[model samples]
Target: MDAVSDFDPARYLSDDLLERIRGRAAAVDAGNVFPDDDLAELRAAGYLAILVPRDLGGAGLSLAEASVLQQRLAGAAPATALAINMHLVWTGVAKVLADRGDDALRFVQEGAAAGEVFAFGISEAGNDLVLFGSDTAATPQPDGGYAFTGTKIFTSLAPVWDQLGLHGLDTTSEDAPRLVFGFVPRTDAVRTRDDWDTLGMRGTQSRTTELHDALAPANRVVRRLAPGPNPDPLVFGIFSVFELLLASVYTGIARRALDVAVETAHARTSKKTGRTYSQDPDIRWRIAEMALAYDGMLPQLEVIARAIDERADHGALWFAKLSGLKHRAVTSAKRVVDEAMLVAGGSSYFTRSELSRLYRDVLAGQFHPSDPESAHSTVAAAWLGPVDPA
Candidate 1:
């Protein structure tokens, strides 16, 4: 048995569930369709409610377990994995709201138990995602409610969201821009198209949602003085777990690439040498290098996961470290995919080869929120103190 099979982070998901997810991804890859069946399989497998508290009739898996499932999911289909990433974020924030005595928490929790899905609405049309703030406006309503009027772009899974979080300027506040977090069900507003058809992660179906004169109760609104700062820092910061899982997914893809490369080398005959390509020392070195990379990522992920589990009170430093880890994970994925492509030679790009699929999926994380440049800058600033570039 391989190490990944032995690790088996998804004890909750039966063999039937795992196979079904893989099959769905395969079908989506072939047909270039939305992973509706994949999401349904996850919901049926109880992964959609993995983060909900046990008292709320959820599985209540730990961060480590969730990370494992996410890694496995990414290995199959990164676009689907990226889309569902919002669920983990929402679950973490929802838990924090519950601790703050917010009434919306229970409803969200209940919805999770019922397999209802929520998506994020952070990045807007003109909002500098790295800094924050969009043109979207949310005005406090007369009946102790709020009216959300804005267009949100890059809203992953918007077409299927049951609950969505909108980040807009709170008209009631005067000082520094107030980062208002408002929750609204998709059924409450009209959605428009952002129509994200990119070079990679094409199947994510990320689109824009426009909310005009949408009414939201006070209980559902979460006002944060600073973005990404939740009432419960510990729970919210655990998203680093996703980063570690992403590393595992990249490693798995690389490992598969190495396997195929070795098989092809042994089978294909070199014209000049009249011998197998595997006989060449350069080919052997690439295989060894790939193995070394996969081995290194696994332990690092475990170390970080254990740290978060042990120290629930990690502060800004934790956020910085999580950012750094995510950067490293994606960077590793980039290198692994690049190396796999080289090792596979021209065959990696062949339409029929599995390496072609893995290569495309691996590049998806290169530009995610956890991109290396921003993450490294955040970590460096934390370490060297914030720079005043006046």
Candidate 2:
């Protein structure tokens, strides 16, 4: 059962489906493989096309609705939710652009409705200049298309993605140092390495992708913007949706931990007091802290996502807000999971325990975009101004 009761994920996700996903999560994680079964079920339910317009044969949900659904899904299976997030992010970006009167990503919305699975391919090993720069080479073809040749790590949905939405640096172009955003289909030039061995989120199978002259055809080449923080709608759209969706996932994990902790507190009795841990002051306080953190996230996430959908202006503070939200969700989730472990006592420490799995899963939250250091720096720059190179 989910922690949230008032909202029903806009009816896009049914409780039965979520329960089925939850049932498969442990097995998937144990095998260290992708959740192919879950994916098939989600696709069959038209969940993949939820963001696509109704005219395009979709559920036509808003960003706020999407966030709620992602949270609900994450509560059941964090890795499944995380992996599907990549696909939803692309569709969500398309929605953001369409709302701003930019149809450059119209193909993405249409593609989603047509049963295509898109994956995110942006991360590079040793490259901290995320979303601002790229190490991959974007070579312009004679037909106005671009051929990408480089590696992208942590490519989620690695096993089943039909399209890889990625970016690369195009130094050879007329506008030198431009970052090219495009999509490439799986071809001989593109390869996915089976190197997804990890401590947690093992079900994601977020392997490394090798692009050796992988082509993004002219029509699919979406945007070419100069590197560094520009006010392009694409940038804001990606940043806003990515951060909000990610926060939703971590927040869901925290909610799950809190629920388990509550259950443990009521079910376990203390030897000294001859009563349940629910009566203990320390356990009660811990549960309250977890509840407070989980409660705190929804309002901000709900407001921000609704604001984006409504096209409200946050101006320059948008990045700071988004980054801060992601950071808070991750940190709070870690704290909640830690407290949950303690409340459950020694049995929770076992690998077979649900709390044990959650503990491992929540750790991956800190590793996502907007890490603690970067998030603090962003918030600091927003208020105190950027640091001087001198």
Candidate 3:
């Protein structure tokens, strides 16, 4: 059975589905390949529709429930999990825009349901976690549509994404700094360049996309929309969901590493002591520390999840609280996985071993925007009181 069968938010997350995803995890990581098969499974299982309303052919599960399901799946396969994460983020934002009478709603919803993947085109040119960059211009075409011409790096799922959730500034209206939010279809004009050969998340296929006058309707673009900003109530809820669930995945991978290490310990003897390595006190302590780290992540995640549910009736302050928990979960998960690797030593580095891939996969968790640095400014600003209207 799936680890979260009874409490499953949507019937989309099933034991059979997880098994299929797990089978591909190692192969994808080893070959540094996208998990196309796993994504197909997710589509078939309706995971893509978890947040969509039932009237719209979705499961319509709440933020609280969805977090539980995501956490379970992420604990097993993080690459696939992260890929799915982008989908939800874009879809959620699109849902709101559509409700705001944005013309692109129908296409966005239908496109997502049809497996037309959308890459969240955030984190623009020259972006360094502080300043957002984008020299790529969006100019109006005489045909009433806009032509998007720019370059975006670290574009996740770009290789297969059919649409892009683009963020840009509409310079045409000088009176207002119109921030454009909309979908850009992957037409012949959209070119992708190889760029995302990173130390981790290599399989995300996070390439750089170059757009040259991609055509789209005026209604297809909504100006003055922020994709996802800090301190929003949903931001905290989603951040907690992301950090804790990713941590859970690392913890699961670490447990697997620990399992392999213990089995090896039982079979091999220490060269100096002439005794099985499993019997060594130092070795035992290392194993114990790994377990402690793994065990700690679960309860901590639960605490944050529960808080989000309770505060849903209120406004955004709860999200700020969630940022703290997210930082802790991400940090603890990295430490656990690191220690798990140490227990296995050089053997864990072997390509044939599962621990090798698990180690590499867990490292990606560190850079997943879960740190306090991202949220410190926002949370502190809220605490200091509101500024005057200048």
TM-score of each: 0.84, 0.97, 0.77
lDDT values, one for every candidate: 0.66, 0.90, 0.63
lDDT of 2 by residue, 283-333 (tens): 999899889888888888888888889999989899999999889888888
Best of the candidates, lDDT:
2
Q: Candidate 3 lDDT, tens digit per residue, 320-378?
A: 55555556556665676666667677877786666666667667665655345655654
Backbone clashes, each candidate? 1, 0, 2
What's the CA error at residue 43 for candidate 1, in Å? 1.2
Off by over 4 Å in 2: 1-7
Q: What C-alpha lDDT does candidate 1 achieve relative to the native structure?
A: 0.66
Instruction: Please list all clashing residue pairs in model 3, or write none if there are none.
Output: 75-249, 125-133
Worst 10 residues of 2 by lDDT: 1-10
**Candidate 1 backbone collisions, by pair:** 194-208
lDDT of 1 by residue, 1-390 (tens): 122334555566566765676566655666555688878877887777887889997877555556666666665666677777677667654554454455455666778889988777766654545224557777777665667788877677766778886666674655545666667876556575757666556566777788886766787775544543444442343245445555555555555565667787688777888888778778778777777776676666666665655545556677677777666666676676777677778977875666777777777666556567678777888789888899
The best candidate in terms of TM-score: 2
Better of 1 and 2 by TM-score: 2
